[model samples]
Target: MPEAIQFVPYVLVVLLTGIPTWKLLVRVGLSPAWAILCLIPAGFIIVLWLIAYRRWPLLEE
Candidate 1:
């Protein structure tokens, strides 16, 4: 396996993605428990909530 690189930019991305993900769920009227999971891959989001939250803002066609 290739060694993982630990750089400032990569760490920043992790913090940026993880923090507001918690807040976004509240804004959307969803439970806090689901916010952290929002940080997961978009494919999982699509699969999990497809029938309800059908609009995928970031996903490519």
Candidate 2:
């Protein structure tokens, strides 16, 4: 039971970061589910580059 309490903050952090990330990705025309990638160090940076370059698939003209 005590161990479970320790996981609460971790879960909250993921939700706090992930939810907004998902929305940001969706607004940029990328898949919203990619939000889970923000939880990873490399993926987080990759997402930043994706946005910085405006390289989402939907951006192709």
Candidate 3:
């Protein structure tokens, strides 16, 4: 039980950031699953690069 309590804050952070990031990724024409990268070290930088280099679906349409 004590061990499980330790994870609560981590889980909350993931949920808080991941949910909004997932939505934004979808809106930007990237896969929502990419939001998981935000939880990783320097992963947000990767996602930013992906958005910067890739063509947006909205723009293509």
- Estimate, for each residue in 1-61, the C-alpha lDDT of model 3 and write its tens digit: 9999999998888788778878878888888889889898588778778777888788898
Q: After superposition, which runs of candidate 1 have C-alpha atoms over 4 Å from their true positions?
A: 1-10, 38-61
lDDT of each: 0.52, 0.78, 0.83
Off by over 4 Å in 3: 52-61
Deviation from truth (RMSD, Å), model 3: 2.0
| Top candidate by TM-score | 3
In order of lDDT, best first, we have 3, 2, 1
Instruction: For residues 13-37, write the lDDT of model 2, one tens digit per residue.
Output: 7787788888888878877777777
Pairs with backbone N, CA or C atoms under 3 Å apart (clashes), candidate 2: none
RMSD of each: 8.4, 3.1, 2.0
Residue 44 in candidate 2, Cα distance off native in Å: 2.8
